[model samples]
Target chain A: MLEYVLSKYNFWTYAILLIIGLYAMVGKKNLVKKLIGMNIFQSAVILFYISIGVKKGGATVPIFLGDAHAAHGHEIIIDAAHYFIPLPHVLMLTAIVVSVATTGVALAVLILIYKRYKTLEMDEIMKIRQDTGA
Target chain B: MIWQLDVIFCLFVIICAIAAINVKDLLAAVIILGAYSFFMCILWTEMGAVDVAFTEASVGAGVGTVLFIAAVNKTKRRSKD
Candidate 1:
């Protein structure tokens, strides 16, 4: 049991992090806290994808080392196993951009909510809404 | 990848994530979140994802923290819960 658990500790850590993020999103009463939870959740997901692309052997980044023109006289052999997978990284680049964009838009909406409601707490906002019947 | 360093960085990341959400002060929480992002970048670099690390450093730690701080400044800093 110990060996199995120790070997896959990274997955365990990510799972714990995901749970924390989810708890914050659901249990937190403040809007900013919920936003922080969302960010944490997104990070955990990106981490999971990056971890998935990792290999257990001698592997480097997926980038060409030598120039193609310099090796024109001889055929260059590329080994797939020698490098980390690039697909997850490429997909995560877009995810990171989307995360930031979501953050910015959420913050803007938060500011607007604060402006109208004069508070950022969920309960307070609900109270105001019910009082105003809106 | 160094498993020891990975474990250490993961510990810090988890701590930062918990602290960031639990802190009552909005500004402090935002700063802690930045620290979390920075630790995450380091972790990614250790895991052999250099490009992801760079992007996380620039965007997550840099711009995200700034946006959160600005929003906190414009609004209330104290969280009731």
Candidate 2:
């Protein structure tokens, strides 16, 4: 029983952290609060990916040998290095770029909203727009 | 390895999703929606889809949340509640 518990502790902890982030994101009202929750959620995902990529006594992939163009460069045959995946790294790079683009677009939209409404409160803005019919 | 943990996590994800949709406050609902992404990321990780988890984390949690907040800040916080 102890062995089972010990072995699965990591999984349990990971789940708890993940849920905590999710709960915050799901239970908040303030826009800023929601953003923070989302950040937390994203961080949790990064952690999960990194954790999954880790393996006991495993070497990192993409091994680099002697200079490729050297006179006597060594030929390095890169291996999969344990079960830790490298696919996540590639995917994460793409994800990061996409998120940055999204953030930029989102900020632009927010700026436009501010210009049109002059307020950040959703209810207040709605009321103003409804009253003005614009 | 006990598989029940997956069930537990799934339960939480379901709760969060429901809260996201059912919350009266628009801002609150957006936040809950963000939570839904976070739980989904965890689910992906557990499924050994580390790449998918990473993508979801960055897009769903980071950019998606920021966008929603920006939209909310420009508009209102609540619809009914």
- Tens-place lDDT per residue, model 2, A8-97, is 554655566567657655764343444444544554565455556555454433324447666356665655564557666566557656
Q: Sort candidate 2 into its docking category.
A: incorrect
Clashes of each: 0, 7
- TM-score of the A chain in model 1: 0.93
lDDT of 2 by residue, B4-23 (tens): 77657656765775466456
Evaluate all candidate structures by whole-model CA lDDT and list the values in order: 0.92, 0.60
Stretches of candidate 1 exceeding 4 Å from the true structure: A72-75
A44-120 per-residue lDDT for model 1 (tens digits): 99999999988878888878778978888998898888888999998998899889999999999999999999999
TM-score of each: 0.96, 0.48
Q: Which candidate is the best by TM-score?
A: 1
Q: Which residue pairs in candidate 1 collide?
A: none
Worst 10 residues of 2 chain A by lDDT: A57-66
Best model per lDDT: 1
Task: Enumerate residue pairs that collide in model 2.
Answer: A25-B31, A26-B32, A121-B76, A122-B75, A122-B76, A122-B77, A123-B76
